[model samples]
Target: MKLPALLRRRAEPAEVGGVARLDRRTKNLTKRLHPGEVAIIHHSDLDRVSAEALVASGAGVVVNAVRSVSGRYPNLGPSILLEAGIPLIDDVGEDVFTLVTEGDRLVVDGDRLLDTEGAVVVSGTLVTTDVLEEQLEQARAGLSDQIDAFTLNTMTYLREEKELLLEGVGVPEIRTKIDGRHVLIVVRGYNYRGDLDVLRPYISEYKPLLIGVDGGADALLEAGYKPNMIIGDMDSCSDAALQSGAELVVHAYRDGRAPGVERVESLGLSAVVFPVLGTSEDAAMLLADSYGARLLVAVGTHYSLVEFLDKGREGMASTFLTRLRVGSKLVDAKGVSRIYRSQVKGWHLALLVLSGVVALVTALAMTDVGGAVGDLLLARLRDLAYWIKELLT
Candidate 1:
């Protein structure tokens, strides 16, 4: 049965089912739930993170607001719920909350479980040992892919400026200043914004050295945070970010060529170029690690093959090397949107009009006898009545 339908037909608290309201970020709320507490998972944007957190928190039944109906494409949400041996009520929508009050009675027939009033009860089992292992494996695999994609995509942009990336600059490598300090590395992407939102409070509390990888400098600025250092090939980074007071480090190839450095200099930004064998993000991490930075937090970093393919990268060697270089100092911010805010861009209309004009001109030039053919067709249409009369006579 559909989740919405099932929720609508749920028995009263005194009859069979118990109710637990779950409308917040699972990452934060999951830790609050006791074992076997019914959880309603909301926040569609962070579906994967929410599912994982809820399952880890040991929720008995996870009723999701955003889910794949009819299993067309298997989502991480339903899979996590199933693996947890938790009954998944899909497509419950908003109305599911209206059916039950804070205290309700509920029972699961598949697992032979029951909950009465505000008390938690389990009959068969909340989650089986085997299912937990399977879920863990799946989650691990998914996380690996996500990281791999992020690494490869970051490399694509680096490779375009390979010559500059390998050249080493003469900046004094301070190896002890950042020791014991939390270092947050920001890379610009959809997930980066969200992760930053969540990390803002933590940043204020911890006061981590904020490092922006290329375009990620703009991300930090947009988040109202000043970056301490900007590292990358310099392409895709905003002009304002370049001008921001952060020290700039351009990733250059080993041959003493620094492409991105020139752009930074052109913007009148002081920078030191470092020739490295890997990606800019990799360079950022390595530089921090080499300099004795304590903890390295990565945001919006790619980690999958598909993501790499989308970025048009060739290999994963650099990412592997960088990860090895950073080791345990890395903490990935894969889903940090539980706290971030962002502005929406409204330039789509202007771009769409420009695209339409370019396409129209290209089509006109490509056709043979384009204008003459169009004129002939118009004349024929105008003489259609004369031809019709002649045919009738």
Candidate 2:
């Protein structure tokens, strides 16, 4: 069982060199990470979504200030980096952040990070597939504890927000007509770009009310669709997205304290405040449900248990309850894309036209009057051809 897996470990190079792009926030760091640049991040227990972002950024090497795995329920980020053929140096300590400056060309030689002066700045574990698998196995044994944490968090959330969850009391009124329309909620989660690409057909057909959650608003823009509404804590999305004329719904704390409100106001823009206990994704869903959306199609949102945990949030508990609240009205984009056959295609139209032409010809050939008309037409075609031949000669 282990032999093939061991053999599947990719051949790693001894050294890699690139310009260093340093940021503690992996999300912000990814935006600036150019191809062949070294990304310096302090992220621990790196989640799948963030890892996917790093991979997509085309970072040549990653140097982390903390353990990427950290025995946190087998987070897939480190493994994803290694599988993408990008070297990950794990746990070089917080001192690396102080030692390394932005745009400094650095070299990863085995386990050591070297600066432009060829001096070793930090030494950390070069994470390989073997290390990743072993750490993941150890992390798997602690999943029961994680589940217990989730349960506790869920109960706490339910106790605190029961009225909002059950009665729909605090959901804000929006001018956007969500009632009797399909609503598409987009989140910047795992395989978001791919999900958006696959959903293009559905998006084009139904023209769902697009609700972008934070960075997901920027995602919608990148996918060439303007969001009808942008919802989140307001940190991840770009300023351009905020100014795109989409209705902004800022997710705030239960105390009515909204950090996004300040940012939106700073931009000379207005937004509706949604004071909710759950995540922005949950807030978007609840808002749609409250406004009487017919069907909710979720794109790039976390669905599986592993995914919830991978987000590194105890607050995913609210998402669990939120799903239960939404019930049958909610649908995954992947599921919809799989089951919903495209209603029309170029080939289908072409086939329809060809069938009509064939039916017309068959009808024309099968009747006596049609046969006489066909003979006369053929004689006229022959006479026209002879005239064309004479002209050519």
- How high a TM-score does candidate 1 get? 0.44
Each candidate: RMSD to true structure?
21.1, 4.9
**What root-mean-square deviation over C-alphas does model 1 reach?**
21.1
Least lDDT summed over 10 consecutive residues: which range in candidate 2?
A: 1-10
As a whole number from 0 to 100, the lDDT of residue 294 in candidate 1 is 84
Tell me the lDDT of candidate 2: 0.90
* TM-score of each model, paired residue for residue: 0.44, 0.85
Superposed model 2: Cα runs more than 4 Å off? 1-7, 335-393
Estimate every model's Cα lDDT from 0 to 1: 0.62, 0.90
Best by lDDT: 2
List model 1 lDDT by residue over 125-204, tens digit each: 22333433344455445655655655665567456534433432332354236767888988774367678887877898
How many pairs collide in each candidate, listed in order? 41, 0
